[model samples]
Target: MALRRLSTLLALTFALGAVAGAVGARTAPRMWADQLVNVTTDDLRWAKTRVRVNVDHWDPGAQTGLHRHPGPTVIYVLDGEVEEVFPDGKTVRLRAGQGVWNPARTSHNVRNVTSEPARVLAVHLDPG
Candidate 1:
C-alpha cells in the first residue's frame, strides 16, 4: 500500500509540473521584427542620422517588457491590436491604421493582449 501511495504522489507531482510549465509558456509568447530599411538621413535638419524601418510581429499574448529606445520612434499598426503601457499607469490600445510616436528615452511596454497575432511598422530616427 505504501508503494502504491508513493506512485500516486509522483504522478500527481508530474501532472502539476506539466500544468505549471504550460501556463508559464503561455505568458511569454515569442516576438520578432523584420528590418525593412536602414539608411542615413541626408536632409539638412537631421543630417547624418540613421533612419531605420522595421516590421515587428507579436504573437498572441506577447509583450515587450519595459524598455526604452535611444532615438525617437514611431509605431503604426498594420494588423491586429496592441496595448501600450506607460510607466505612469497609462494604457493605450491601438488598432489597425493607428499609430503613436514615442520620444527618445521614453519608458514603455507594448503588449498584444488579444488572441490574434499583431504586425506593426516601426520607424526610428537615431542620432549619428
Candidate 2:
C-alpha cells in the first residue's frame, strides 16, 4: 500500500499546485472594472501619464454617451462593427480586429450601428 500512499500524495501535490497557479494568475496585475467608473488607478505603465482600463460592451443600436479622455486612448474592437463618433459628428467605423486611437482630451462616442452587438477593449491614458 506504500505505492497507493505515494500516488495519493502526488495527486494532492498536483491539486495544490493548480490552485496556487490559479490564485496567482487572478491576483496578478491586470485590469478590473473598478478603474473605469470609480477612477481608481494602480500601476499604469501603458498610460505613462494616467492609465485607465475600460472594457466596454454594446448592444445593437447602443452608444457610449459623450465622453473625453485626458490622453491618447486605444479602442480594440472585439466583435461586430462599431462607429466611433467624434465631437464634430464625424464617425470612424471599426470592424472586428480594428482599433482606434484617440488623442488626449479627444471627445467621442462609441455606437454599435449594426444589428449585431459588439464589444470593445478601451484603454484610456490617465496621463498622470
Candidate 3:
C-alpha cells in the first residue's frame, strides 16, 4: 500500500510540474518564426527576386528590435495586436486581419503591447 501511494504521489507531482512548465512557456516573452514558403524567381523585371512567407509568433509584451529588410515587405496580423514603430518616430497599431507594407531599407520595430500573445504573417520580396 505504501509503495502504491508513493507512485501515485509521484505521478501527481509530475503532472503539476508539467502544467506549470507549459504555463510558464506560454507566457514567456519571446518570438519565433516559421517559414511557410520560399521561392526564388528570375521572371520579374527586377530579376532574381526571392519571395518568402513566414508566420511569426510573439509572446505578450514581446518586441522585435530595430531592424531593416533588404527589400519590400508586408506583415499581416493574424491574431492579437501589434504596434509597428518606425525610425522616424511614427507608430502604427495593427489588429487581426490588418496589414502594413514597408518599403525596402525601411527601419522599424514591432511590439506586442497587449496582454495577449500575437501572431503575424510576413511576406517579403527580397532582391537575390
Candidate 4:
C-alpha cells in the first residue's frame, strides 16, 4: 500500500543519512533531546500504557539525525523555527505554537534553521 512504500523510502533515506554521518559528509549541528517523562503500565487490551515525552533543544543550524519512532509521535514547537524533512524529500517549516504528527517508523529529521536555539516538546504513545 501507499504507507508501506513511504516507510520503505524513509528507511532508505535514514540509511543514507547514517552513512553520511559516519563518513563526516554532513554538516549539521547536533541536537540535544532529553526525556522528561516515561510511564508504563500493564492492564487492558493494548494492555499497557506507555507515554514517552521529551524536550528537544537545538542550537542554531543544529538538527536531529534521521530517526524513526516505534509509535506515532506528536511534536509541538515551543520556541524558534524548525525545518522538518521527510524521507521522500518533503520539507515543512514550523514556527512557535505549531505542531506536527509523525507517523510511526517513518524516518525524518528536524533542523533548527534560525539564529537562536529552538525547543520542541515531543510526545509518544506506546502499548507495552
Prediction 2 global C-alpha lDDT: 0.60
Error of 2 at 51 (Å): 1.6
lDDT of 4 at 2: 48
For model 2, residues 1-128, the per-residue Cα lDDT tens digits are 64575356435533443343334232111232321222123443432445455445566777757888777777777567889998887989999768877878889987778987665656655666
2 or 3, which is superior by TM-score?
Answer: 3
Ranking by lDDT: 3, 1, 4, 2
TM per candidate:
0.66, 0.62, 0.67, 0.64
Name the best candidate (by TM-score): 3
Candidate 2 vs candidate 3, lDDT winner: 3
Clashing residue pairs, backbone N/CA/C < 3 A, model 3: none
The local lDDT score (0 to 100) that residue 10 gets in candidate 1 is: 38
Candidate 3 per-residue lDDT over residues 41-72, each given as its tens digit:
22233345565555566877778789999988
lDDT tens digits by residue: candidate 4, 1-128? 64675356445533443343334322223535431222222232342435455556667887777988887776777667898899899998999778888877778998887887666666664555
- C-alpha local distance difference test of each model: 0.66, 0.60, 0.67, 0.62
Model 4 residue runs over 4 Å out of place are: 1-47
lDDT assessment of candidate 3: 0.67
Compute the lDDT of residue 123 as modeled in candidate 2: 61
Instruction: Give the TM-score comparing model 1 with the true structure, all chains together.
Output: 0.66
Q: Could you give me the TM-score of model 2 versus the true structure?
A: 0.62
Stretches of model 2 off by over 4 angstroms after superposition: 1-41, 45-48
Q: Which 10-residue window of candidate 3 scores lowest in summed lDDT?
A: 35-44
